[model samples]
Target: MSVVKGLLYPLPLLIGFACAPSALGAFLKDSKLNLNLRNFYINTDYREGHAGTSKAEEWGQGFRLLYESGYTDGKIGVGVDALGLLGVKLDSGKGRHQGSTTLTSDGDHAADQWSRFGATLKLKASKTDLRVGTLMPKLPVLVFTDTRPLPQTYQGGMVTLRELDDITLTAGKITQVTGVASADRTGMAVAGGRRQSNDFRFAGVDYRTRDNFLLQYYQAALEDYYSQQFLGVSHIWKVTEGRSLKSDLRYFRSRGIGANAAGEPGYQIAGYTPDHRGEIDNDTWSLAFTYAVGRHSFMLGYQSVSDDSDFVHLNQGSLSGDLGARGASTYLIAERLQSYFGRAGQDTQIAQYSYDFAAKGIPGLNVTVAHQDSEGIQSFAGSSLRERETDIILTYAVRSGPLRGLGLGLLYGELNSEVTPDQNQLRLMVSYNVELF
Candidate 1:
């Protein structure tokens, strides 16, 4: 507590700056308009465990527009940002289906239509800012999931302060969620049920030193569900001439809170609650290391789960298990594959390898492979879940041609689990990014 208080001790001094009067044109930057264009194509294939269940493949094209308003010409700057997103199904229907999104119906075929718009507002003062409305947050406990045709967004208000050197403070309350696959925004709640909590709340602080060392502390609460705390650290070091190694360590602790735990007895009777105790407490930790040599990079990581269920995902939903799928995510605040971590008492081992074509005189080609294995899961007597996942990624981009920013990727994954369903996937993606000043 003392450490945290010391970090926030500068708030009063920074508040003074925000309240101080400013002369005309003294604190404002001219407003400007920026446009970015993206053309994206994706194809996915899914193979289901049961032959009777529908297997699927899907393809789509999407366009995203982002517009930002320059700060107001005032001491307390104000602005707005509008994001326009549209996804059009290029192929889909009954024999081969894709998703359960409202945008798609009973057919394996897609609706042949495009879905679209979300926006946000901002207010800034000194080194602090408040953002509200359509939001994509990439925080430790909550992350916007965007692994499909569209990007997921949330409805929330958040404040960030960077008034302290090498330190940042963040807090927020969220009310609803907008899924990546649909245009509708649903009331927010815990992932496994109809439970809803008063605006979800969170606060955290992180610091990164000049020496490439990072430290973080965070707490997040979901009304009637759970409250979680996360702490993490990372360091990057040069291991040899022209070679570097990076280490990342992370931990999360959680407990059932309010309604989720107290009322769990009733839910348990209905086969909803999976554990006892008004609290859902578990300890999760991981250590990852990466080393780079010329154009070849290799990473190895290990994680442990001390609970009976998988780690939490804010708005986790089922995937279609389609043909080609890519699970990569962007945005620092969004959830990572690391989020869906464990099923209590489970330990997982991960390995990954990648190569850049730059070493081979192929400017924009790269390849990667990753695998994970987990065990010690909860199951009927004499059985434990043994899941193995393998992923392959291939990417190519134009080097110095007219299509400088054009990029293409092929992703493939296969999952084999003991006493668990089987899942296989494949995905191909193409994208172009253009910047206009």
Candidate 2:
């Protein structure tokens, strides 16, 4: 929970120079600046009791500014992208500021403020682009986390090509990541590793059909950690005028790599698995079906993880010194509030229902409820471990007047687990965005 000072000081200087009309030539004329004002609050009540603390709650205000410059007038266009973030603590005391969800702890107390700045250099040529800097990538294999006030960011270089119709190719190398609650960047690691790996490289391709079919494949490797491959497919079939069904399938395979496979105990991941092997050998797959009728949608899914190892993803808890960071996320729908449901030999079933109020003359409003059940976790022997979670979310947006770009969201979740503590969580957020030229 160490906050990096002076990390965002360069942002104001860069903004000052870039915003000057006379300095950037055509870059200034075509640039776009957007600012988001966000207010967030979270409350977590530990049901099993949290060792002298029963609840953790915090509230904060966040500011996110993004500036993107259009490609300069040339065959090989060049531009710069910058991100500026600032978070202000609105309310938090010693007992409630344990860094559960909202704010990072600083010497037994939450920090008063935190800020970060990042910039990207870009080059574009004939529908292809290369960018080297901070990025937030949302892919099947690696998705950035944005569940909190500020989104997570990664330091890396990526190349994207879309020269072919209905297809996209991407590749990147990421060395470090900055978590949502911290200003400092750390090396990448799995759930429980004593060290970090500076090398996390990936490549992928996505192909889509005109008839609403998509296919994807990606491969990634974290040096001395694990090598992972992902495959996904999605298809949408229209049943009638206002009815449709979507089918989504995803799979992942992970195994130890480099030192992780060299029989060295120091390279192994940290977690409970079959026989306490702590190795990276797992296969997981999930399939989901969704049916939509007018403004209503229903979804069901099933997921299975292998019996030898837990599902793996890019996690950095090992770099936090005390191993206290628990803010890891993935694209899996089974990742609930208290658990990822990714333990070895786990099978998960999910159901969801959502409705849009626009059809009922209440535009800009939506509600969703979901439930997930997971069983057969290896951590609990004998009768097999089981966990269940129920979540509800509501969102609304201002569609007119002075608050046209304002939005509000609320979420509530409850978790019951056989091997872990049962808990309840709530989050409320309000956001507004403005464009500055």
Candidate 3:
């Protein structure tokens, strides 16, 4: 593993220099570098129930450096991009440390610091581009999580083509991933499965019309686990000069494939399954509507999960043996700050309101509040359960002067559940970015 990691880390840099030696001037002239600093603090209190710990709190400072080189001038242009990430622990003790959310664990306490580096080699020809090495994809079929101090990263290769007007095509395959809290990379797996699969493939297409309409279809499969297909549509209508309404609809169908279908030992999924057999069979759908007028915006949505299994995604959280691989995100309406609300046979309703203070003379301030109620959940013990969550967020950014580009934010969330422990969480953050030539 160490040998493979070492070779992969410098492969992009080598390839870029070798392929674009003659166009070094253009690459150097168009290069860009940036540095971002972040200070994050989080506290979670378990209001009821008994697991082990009652509360978890942590504070950390993070640094991210990014560099991007311009593509060489030619029919097939070549470029390179690099990333460096570092996280330093500010406050965390044995009792206060949580499971690899913001910081990795060392013995019984949190690690003092952690860091990693990655690079990508890219080539472009006509309206198509190909990238290899580290990737952070944000698509309907697969999206990377960045909720913690450091963002999760994947090792893969992808190609994107925009040859047709108002249309896009994408395909990719990922072999490994490094979690946000850990610096080590591991094979890919789902939430409840202990086995790892190095082959995950996906392809998608997006088409847009002239009349504010978008249509999408995507297919993905994790080897020996499950296969999934997604369909989505979106539209926007202008009610007046300052008012608009938007509607979004999404659907997914998934079923067990190789090992999972055969009921293998380590390939079984977690959550509620029919007949107590851990097979992946699910159909999930959601619809949302948003109305915006002036500085205020309102949104409402509904989601439904099939009773056969929980909604599945590329989740490594259940791989307890892998350090820092305990966090993931899904493209679902129920993906809240504290709880995802993605359980078997669960149905969710969501409401949100946000206000931009610019209309009230505060140009860089904003506030948002959201609520979610979910019920009809089927637990593994053959019982029914329910859960709900409420979240509030406030943010301010300095738009000018010495403190320009500085941002401050606060978030609070509370969750009440019938099957799990009730909890409340608070988060504070400050961030700034610097541009370097």
Positional deviation of 43 in candidate 2, in angstroms? 0.7
lDDT of 1 at 163: 97
lDDT of candidate 1 over 82-194, digit per residue (tens): 66666666766565654544233334555664544666677899999999878888887777766565677778899999999999999999887766656555655443444
- Work out the TM-score per prediction: 0.81, 0.93, 0.95
lDDT of 3 by residue, 296-376 (tens): 999999999999899988888777564677788888876889988778888999999999999888889999999999998
User: What are the per-residue Cα lDDT tens digits for candidate 2 across 391-428?
Assistant: 99999998988888899999999988876667899999
Error of 2 at 65 (Å): 1.0
Model number with the top lDDT: 3
Candidate 3 Cα errors over 4 Å, as ranges: 1-19
- Shift in Å, residue 175, candidate 1: 0.9
- Report the poorest 10 consecutive residues by lDDT, candidate 1: 265-274
lDDT of each: 0.63, 0.82, 0.87
Query: How much is 132 displaced in model 2, in angstroms?
Result: 0.6
Worst 10 residues of 3 by lDDT: 1-10
| Model 3 Cα shift for residue 287 (angstroms) | 0.5
